[model samples]
Target: MTNEKRLPPLLKLALELGPLALFFVANAYADRFGFAEGQRIFFATALFIGATLVALAVSYALLRKLPIMPLVSGVVVVVFGGLTLFLQDETFIKLKPTIVNTMFGAILLGGLYFRKPLLEIVLDSVFDLTEEGWRKLTLRWALFFFTLAALNEIVWRTQSTDFWVSFKVFGIMPLTIAFALAQTPLLLRHEAKKAEEA
Candidate 1:
């Protein structure tokens, strides 16, 4: 993709986050519009599927390439969301986070087992870190993903559907952003060390 055609940060964030916001809104009003409980969830799942496709399309159109993270997420969303609507079981959708997070954690940690820091590939465009820094950051993220997977299982199994939906929409994103922000000092320190070596 040409630099000029690349999506700006704000627009990219919107593409990634808009579908989730739509899902939350759709679920919130599903009942007021008289949808039955099952149908409400089905409606929200359907909307999520459509919104994910739209977001991916917009990303490709503007950036000329699909982002790796969102592409994986979009695929899972369609698959699990389809199963949820097809089986009329909310369990499928609720299990999506657990599956996705577990997969990510495994991929990252497995890369470390092979002495490769896969996070460097994912975030290299945004961060410049020493080799040790990449290893540390990758380990931290792997643990964090595992924690999120466990939390998803607990929340979905114990909570009401609406509560789970709210947690998915409101809870996860903030936690991720906060976690990323908390690593800023580590990131800056590593970048400074790299600069000194250069």
Candidate 2:
């Protein structure tokens, strides 16, 4: 995949994480900005929607294409975040993560069921792996996504909006990064080597 386009690491991080940071900050300061007691989540939802759209546009400009995962996640955020703001209910925004994570998990598992190894399609630029490696890695990611979905369900249903907002940015992000980094050995062990040029 020498020809695959790659975003520089820091730019990629900003494109992905900047929207979440804005969401967290907007929610935290909504009160100071004169939003009512129960309306701060709506304020955050609106910002999240806008920020996600901006991020996607920036990504498209830089890469000439949107990455699969973020593109899917951005669509879900816009839809659910719109519902949250429109219905004046925070439940929809809170459910966004559970829905997105579960959808990803199901898609990965479904791909494996058909022996497709779809993660390769999304990650080929980052890693070159054997078929077995792709299968193992996809299964692990599928399980991890399901775990994240369950965790989101538990936290949002049981915790306050402020707590959920904090957890989304501070807790879930860290867990995701840690889990992805932990896959380094598997990625290294199964990396595919290219033939030498004649």
Give the number of the best model, judged by TM-score. 2
- Residue-pair clashes per candidate: 0, 0
Tens digit of lDDT per residue, candidate 2, span 29-69? Answer: 99999998798889988999999999999999988998889
**Per-model CA lDDT versus the true structure:** 0.89, 0.92
Off by over 4 Å in 1: 1-6, 192-198
Error of 1 at 172 (Å): 0.8
The lDDT leader among the candidates is: 2
- lDDT, candidate 1, 32-123, per-residue tens: 88898767878888999999999999899877888777898899999999999988998998899999999899999999999999998888
lDDT of 2 at 187: 89
